[model samples]
Target: MTIKEKADEILYKTGLYEELKTYGEPHPIGSYRMDMMVYNDLDIDILNNSMTLEKLHTLTNYILKTFRPTWYEAREEVNDEGKTVWFHGFHAILMDELWNFDLWFFDRETITKAEAYCDTITTRCHQNPTLKTTITTIKKDLLTKGLYHYDKYTSMDVYHAVLTENITTTQAFLKTHPLTTY
Candidate 1:
């Protein structure tokens, strides 16, 4: 099945697949075609917290199947200070409030990685109420931490800052939530 078809099937299974066919020509970004695919909003309050595990599993399966992120990077093993971490390796900047994978790019692999990370986080958020709360908290932190400044730009746009080590993977992610740096 095609990527789009796979994604559609997963989204349909979730009963949240509202196809946005208006996305026109793919925007040229480096070596890949960039396009917004399924955009969905899952109302957290409506979902029963007691069955969050089931809900999160379904959501994670949907994303892993839908997006088919082949290059999804494993969680970073350690931090700069040698601290162990799992979810901190990469960052995801969710678009609006939609859980739908709105961002995808072929050439730039980081986009795919970021989407994968977002998918994982969103699933975890569904599994735990505190994670749900943290989403807003982190978003607020981004604004205060000056991360919002990089949200509008791309990896290509900030290639220099990344290569020069001015930003670590975590910092880069914090900046714009991109999964990988150029």
Candidate 2:
């Protein structure tokens, strides 16, 4: 089976796959595709409790243990837009014979923002089928070239570059933007 299929099987066994598909949407980020699951307001309130946060961490640890992926790491990033903000998340990489699977976990606000961004892109794709086709072609090309690394660029970045900046090819996009400096 393909790595994605294997990952899906594991996720389904854990019930996370269905929960995410029900509550979230798919987002292709760099070389990996993630389900950006956003917690509802009520759920967010429930998660605000310290005990609940601890339990969530415990659950995360359990998943990491159960999956025994190649690597699992927790991450915190600080984003500033006139004000400093921090986001906490974790990602696990599962490697198979032919491919890799990355699973991401994020806080409510961050996932909500991601969901909105994905929705905008989806809207754009629906409005212009040609743009969608372009994105698919570029992604396939990048995958073939072994250039679709999460640390370097994402399909979303490619789509934005093509749709907004008139950068049509992956080479041009890579030339202009390169990987993020930091």
Candidate 3:
């Protein structure tokens, strides 16, 4: 099967595809366990104080335990200034070995703008056939360089860079952003 078909199958098995189609894309909040952004639509102040964070932690823990993932992992990295920062969320192999996904939860007041941005990217990709191949090549190169992560950079960023800056290859992209990890 094609990569997109494989991804769709995985999402369907994990139930995320259904949830996303029903409720839209979820907003990410960085923390111990990645919490689903379900609470974002509520009045809860996810970032206000420690109490809210604690509650979110508890909720996330409960969800994780209930899911009973095969295994989970977290990452940490040091920034340019030398302070170590843990990456915001956990990577989970949920249900089975094939179901690898990230979990992040936090509260955001609105996801309309983010969702719109996603739609724009999708539309752009559909309009520009070559754009998808360029993005895929860039992602593969970034993965080989060990810099393929949503937190590191995104396909949308790469797409915009290629369109606006005339970046034709991954090497060109790296040249443009010398400070980037890749």
Candidate 4:
């Protein structure tokens, strides 16, 4: 099935079925809209807070859901007017693929603008001593075991581990770090 179908199925199962709205489009068919407002809940507190693991966990899960894997690369972009706002989305290849799910996260932020968000992720995966190891381990495990690896009862398998453990790590990181607000 297609991503839109999968998303619709998820919404239906979750009982979040809502009316679809439409507006004039920049192109021919017309612009369609939906109330996929989950990203709206990502308040500024999520950025400026020093919680490391919490922020990371939140970010990863977010990207995974908002921009599920497709034939496109995931990206974090920004648009600045006197201020700046961040967007977590996929290129049109993925965008078109998941059009029904509204595959983009519009996070209107000041400090954690698109550039900063990208930089933060880069630093964690590349610069930080401990984080680099953590990310590497996760990637290796993901590659070795593929989809079901995370479900394995092993502490080393980071990605397939329990969801609550992920939450705990995220909360702990947030408690230890200071992600300054914009």
Best-performing candidate as measured by TM-score: 2
| Global Cα lDDT for candidate 2 | 0.49
Candidate closer to the true structure by lDDT (higher is better), 1 or 4: 1
The order by descending TM-score is 2, 3, 1, 4
lDDT of 4 by residue, 147-178 (tens): 21224322223322322244224334334332
For each candidate in turn, the TM-score is 0.25, 0.58, 0.55, 0.24
Itemize residue pairs with steric clashes in candidate 1: 31-107, 32-107
User: lDDT by residue for model 3 over 1-182, one digit each (tens)?
Assistant: 44344444445675644443332234322211111111111111122112234444554464366445455453444546564333223334432333334532222322344445555655666798676567667867876786655677555567677667868799888778665555
**lDDT for each of the candidates?**
0.34, 0.49, 0.46, 0.32
Q: In candidate 1, where is summed lDDT lowest over 10 consecutive residues?
A: 40-49
Count of clashes, each model:
2, 1, 5, 14
**Prediction RMSDs, each to the true structure:** 17.0, 7.3, 9.0, 17.0
Native-referenced Cα lDDT, model 4? 0.32
Better of 1 and 3 by lDDT: 3
Q: Taking the tens digit of each residue's C-alpha lDDT, what string does model 1 give over 1-182? A: 43344444444554433321122112222211212122221211111112233433444454455454433333324446454322201122222222323222122233345445445544544676554443344434444555533454333333333333334343444555453546
lDDT of 2 at 99: 26
Q: Tell me the tens digit of each residue's lDDT in model 2 across 96-172.
A: 33223333344456556755666677677678777766676676667677776566556666777878987777677
lDDT score at residue 136, model 4, on the 0-100 scale: 40
Residue pairs clashing, model 3: 34-103, 34-104, 34-105, 35-104, 35-105
